[model samples]
Target: MPAADWWRSAVIYQVYPRSFLDSNGDGVGDLPGITAKLDYIASLGVDIVWISPFFTSPMKDFGYDVADYCDVDPLFGTLADFDALVARAHALGLKIMIDQVLSHSADNHPWFVESRASRDNPKSDWYVWAAQQADGTPPNNWLSVFGGSAWQWDARRGQYYLHNFLTSQPDLNFHQPAVQQAHLDNLRFWLERGVDGFRLDACNFHFHDRELRNNPPAALRDSTMVSSVNPYGMQAHIHDKTQPENVAFLRRIRVLLDEYQAIAIGEIGADDSLAVMGEYTTGGDKLHMAYSFNLLTSEFSAAHIRTQVEQFEARVADGWASWSVGNHDSVRVMTRWGGATPSPELAKVVLAMQLALKGTPCLYQGDELALTEADLPFEALQDPYGITFWPEFKGRDGCRTPMPWQGASAHAGFSSATPWLPVPPEHAARAVDQQAAADSPLSFARNILAWRRGVAQLGQGDIVFFDAPEPVLAFRRDLAGAPSLLAAFNLGGAALQFDWPQAAGATPLDGHGLPGAAEGAGVSLPAYGGWFALV
Candidate 1:
């Protein structure tokens, strides 16, 4: 792959800074902790390390609520620690990609603080503010993704400001040219800091309708982006987010990234996230690639996986996608998709399937260890979203538990002091030390990644799914002047023997570390097994 197109065939390993490792015994992971783990990340054979937000924040929504876009938060470390992390990551040939939350800022952010102080200040119009109605209600019916009204009344300004997430995270007014320029300047700061790329957080939420029109009721109940219990999903969200103005802003961002030969992958959470992903990445003058919440839902089926890829490929002629099944926000894939008793075989199969898709694959921190979501009591939860809606929806704290480095060490070697969240005993049993064994899922992850690097067809190929029964996903990756690579994954627990016409006369591709075999047109797969071949 060309240097500029390096991300095309790359694998991104996401480091949720708070849960990755703790170097200072602060009970929270930090930049130095990530720096110390560069070698281990490099060992995974992933090309990029997409670190989640470690920027200055008040920790309302973890680091997503940025207070200083250009500086690191003291909780994570100083800018010097971030610089050291970049240097170490580069030494290991790992490209560092940090999160850029451009849509909103912490209410305490200087800009928000200044904007909310008075209506006549220089930054007064920086945020989305509007006057209340005759009845003293919010300006509109837009609802927050967390809960309640999106509009928060600011007594100082005598107006309401929009917050799609927590009230502490105030939405930025992208309609203001100065706000746009300020964010651009912030991007330039990181670009000059020697970072390779950025993971644009809520990239589609950068713009809202200038008219501030009331959003209509949803044509259907949408549960993919927000929890079903939240009223945020009841509306179409037409006026509040995913506006067309975002396309231009994305182009502006791409131009800056092009100057540094840096790449960007946006995170899209909209009513029609796949469509927004296509819109953001189609022109190449926008995002380099984008991923959506489509795959992060609890729906795990061969049909569901096939539909997501096929739909994107059908709509996006010149765009790209970064497919991710696990992230900090959702329940761990093991528990969400793999049922009550998720096995290591399930992890291997999921990773293999994600890798075989016709896009970049992003792996979450502990998925390689087959880490199940940690079950915590209500008192132990730190996530505000969970605290608000306790029983029905438990929030993301389950997936944000500390990494288990050593099974026998105190706090699983995550920290000498007590961790912010307890490391589940189940996760401790599957720590890095134990998962390093030859037959472990971690080893399987390393082996498959290494094997994938050698296969050009798998990296650059057009995907075509075969008509297979439920619980079995079959697809072929075709590239010019090379044999087509055929893949079949058994998504369920039972061993399956299926007759696949596409696999006839295909040469079995081995060394992938999963159990499966094919003889002529007949294929056999163990529980959660995958089969690969070159035809």
Candidate 2:
């Protein structure tokens, strides 16, 4: 793939920095720790490595609250450590995409501190500040994604400020020209430092309603982005976010990225995320691609998966999508999609299905081992989101637990010291060292990825889904002047025998190691099995 369009169908491996590895035994993963694993990441045959935020922050919302956009947090190491990481990743032919949380900054950041200092300060309008209502209530009915009211009263300003998340992470005022320019400069800083691109966090939240209109009650609750228990889902979120002004700002970001030949994939959460995704990426003057929580939710079925892709394709003109089955924010796919008794076979099937889709595929860390979500005691929980929601909604700590490298080592070889989060013994059982067998999910992931490289249609072709039964997902990848590729996945546990008329007379393709066979129009698939052929 050419460097310019390399990200078009690239497979991205997300490395949550805090749990990837601990180099100096600090009980936390760092830049150097990631640097030490570049060769391993390259071995997966993935094209990009997206590292979550490690910026200067107090870690209130972990690293999402940025205090210094231009510096690495001491917990992760210094600027030199980041430079070395970039060098190592580039040497391994892997592009580095760091998280850019421009929508908000830590309240302690110099800009936010100064902005909240006094109403007459030079930076007073840098953040979203609003006046209190006549009855001493908040300006509007917008609620925080974390919980409670989105407005927090600032004593110094005698007014309220908007925070779509935690109060400490105050939303920036994109209406301010200076704020826009400042973020652009920050992007330039990293691009100059040899970083490949960025994963724009909450990209749609960059702009909000200027009039401060009250958001109406949601016609239907939206649990895709937040827990159903969260009141954040109760509102339609029309005025508070997904503003029209965000498009121009995205255009500016694209212009900046073009100058450096860098790419950007945005994270979108909205009332209509699919539509917003299409709007932002269609013109090609905005984000290169975008992903929503539609596939990341607890809903798992052949219909659910097919609908998301079809809906996104319908809305986009020429936009692309980065479909991910797992990420840091949600329960592990093996647990969420899999039943009480999850199977490694399901993990292999999920990987095959995600790769076969007509878009970029993003794989989360430790998922190759088919690691299930870790169950942590409430007292041991560190995530504030989970703590607030309590037993009803256990936060993301389950998925953010330390990666298990060795089954027999301390903390599963993730750290010499005690890890920030305890590694589950169940996860240790499926650690990288233990899953070295050819039949392991890790080995299957490698084989499938290597096989995908040789199939041009899988990488760059139009997708068409066949109407099959509930447990079976059948699709064909069509490329001009070449035989079409037919793929069918059995998402259920029971072995199945189905007839796919479209797959008649298709030639079976090998190299991808999965147990499935087809005879004319009849296909036989084992539990969580997949079949591939050239039709």
RMSD, each candidate, Å? Answer: 0.9, 0.9
Among the numbered candidates, top lDDT falls to: 2
RMSD of 1: 0.9
lDDT of 2: 0.93
Off by over 4 Å in 1: none
User: For model 2, how many clashes?
Assistant: 0
List, residue by residue over 443-502, the lDDT tens digit for candidate 1.
999999999999887788999999888899999999899989999999999998899988
Q: Where is model 1 poorest over a 10-residue stretch in terms of lDDT?
A: 1-10
Q: How much is 190 displaced in model 1, in angstroms? A: 0.8
